[model samples]
Target: MTVDHTAPGDLAPHPVDLRAGELAALLARAHNIPADVHRLPSGEPVVSVYYGLVVRIDDTCRFWWVVPASVGRRRPLWTSATVPAVAASRIAGHYRELRARPPGHLIRGGYLTADVLMEHHTASAPI
Candidate 1:
């Protein structure tokens, strides 16, 4: 599906449709944020050492991703996206590529919404 290009400032989030196996594999190879560096708890730069993220994939090929609002918190805020299978596969593929890259490359400074996944959905995203 094509991504909506409206500005992100007023955008709302729904559920993130993800490929389960793809998401799991991505987390397996992802790195945690360093404690020394201060950063936002949500949106881009989410991976942390304390607790991992949650993901779900459906037969329709839609997927959802959820992460705790705070470190080690049980409650989570989730976001869904409208991404086609090819795009989803590409996202998974990027993680796979990163698995071979250094830790610094895994740090993602991006955002996601219901209709739009990220800048990469339409163009290239710095990995």
Candidate 2:
């Protein structure tokens, strides 16, 4: 089976698909964003992390937050050809928000919606 790497908004296949080791190295430096590189059934490497952040490198080496379909249909978060560090920082913040959310807020089973991932958490929100 051919695994399509075209994310929601892309018109064609991405030219630069980071190898597993390269993806792992980027995540390894992100101390707070617990992540691991895993292969798709088609053998494509994807970086999986908490809060349903399954990242893919594409569109000339940019980072994208690929959302799981079980949760929602929001567009993936694309970093637009920026450095990995910027993507890492955004991912770290995204993780923090998801971690801070109150139980049953936007999580279902073991998955979460991209909408909740982008929402701002308030100080008064119950954890």
**Highest-scoring model, TM-score:** 2
RMSD of each: 15.9, 12.2
| lDDT string, candidate 2, 1-127, tens digits | 9999987878743344444345556556755455776645544445666656656554356566633332354533333325776667666666665666654754653455323432321122122
The residue-level lDDT of candidate 1 at 30 comes to 46
Misplaced by over 4 Å in model 2 are: 1-20, 66-81, 102-106, 109-127
Q: Please, what are the lDDT tens digits per residue for candidate 1 over residues 7-111?
A: 977765422322443443444444221211112323332222221222333335454444323336534344454353443444344334434544442334222
Could you say which candidate leads in lDDT?
Answer: 2
- Model 1 TM-score (2 dp): 0.27
- Candidate 2 least-lDDT 10 residues: 118-127
Which ranges in model 1 have alpha carbons more than 4 Å from their true place? 1-18, 29-52, 71-75, 82-127
Lowest-sum lDDT 10-residue window in model 1: 32-41
